[model samples]
Target: MNAPYIHGRRRTFSASAAVDTQNAVITSIKTDDGATWSDMGRVLGKSEDRAAAYANTASPIDLPTFLAGCHEWGGRFADPLLALVGGRWADAGAICTGDEAAALTIANLLPAIIAIEADNLTEPHELLPHEVLIRRVHALTAIWLEMIATEKGRAR
Candidate 1:
C-alpha cells in the first residue's frame, strides 16, 4: 500500500504505469495534436516510422521521446506524471508584466507567515486553506521563475 501523505494521496510510482502513460503521451501527440510520428521521430532523432511503433505499444520510451511528446502538446496531460515525480513543466513563452505577478501572488497568499513551528506546521492562524495554498505556491513559483528568467535574459 502507498503511504498516506498528510498533504494528500499520491500514487506509488509504477514503472509499468509510467511506460503506459508515456506511450499514451506519444499517441496523443499524433491523434490530438496532429503531430505525425515522423515529426516526433525527427525531434527524437529517429526515422519516419520509428516513433510510430512506440506510439502504439506498452514499451518503455527514452526520456527524449517522452519530452518531445510532451512538448508538442503542452502539459495538461503530462502534469500528473510530472507531479508524480515532484516536478512541473512550464511554457517558455509565458508572459507577465511589471510588478504585477508579485503583487498578485502576495494578494492571493493570505494568512501571513507569522509563526512557523519547530515542527513543520504553521500556526493555525497562519495557515491558508489547502486549495488556497496550492494556488499561492503556483503563483509564487511562476513569479519567481519569471524573475530569474528575465534576469538571465538581460545578462545575455
Candidate 2:
C-alpha cells in the first residue's frame, strides 16, 4: 500500500498521486496554445474528455514522485533481466564450462539498459512538448517490458 504524506509531519510516497501528476503533465503538454486536447488524446491513446480534464485539473507533478515512478517501473522490468543473467551463470556452472560469451553479451547490454532507465525516470516532461515526451516514455516502457519477457523466456 502507498503511504500517506503529511508534509509538515510524516512524508510517504504515493504512487497514485504520481500517476495523477503524470496525467496532469500530459494534459498540460497537450493543451498548450499550439496543441489541442484532441490531438494530445490521440497521441496518448486517451479520450478527448479525459485529456481535457487532465489539462483542466492538472497539478504539478512533484519531482520525487515522478522519479519514484520511473524507478518502480524500471525495477519491475529489470528483475527478469537480472534473473536471466543468473540463469546463464547457472548454465555455465552446470555445463562445466563458463558461458562467458553469453554472460559478456548480457553484460554489454546492461549499460545501455541502465542509461535508458535513468533517462526514462529522471528526464523531465518539460524537456519536450507534452505529446513527444509522453510518447517517448510509453515507447521506452514497452521496450522495457519486452526485455523482461524475453529474459524470462530465456531463463526458462
lDDT of each: 0.64, 0.47
lDDT of 1 by residue, 53-99 (tens): 67666667777766765665568556756866756667787663433
> Where is model 2 more than 4 Å wrong at Cα?
1-12, 31-33, 57-156
Q: Please give me the total number of clashing residue pairs in predicted model 1.
A: 0
After TM-score superposition, the amount by which residue 141's alpha carbon in candidate 1 deviates from its true location, in angstroms, is: 16
Per-residue lDDT of candidate 2, residues 67-116 (tens digit):
43234333332232223333211322356443244445455555555665
Where does the lowest 10-residue lDDT sum fall in candidate 2?
Answer: 83-92
Model 1 misplaced stretches (Cα beyond 4 Å):
1-11, 67-80, 91-156
Native-vs-model 2 lDDT? 0.47
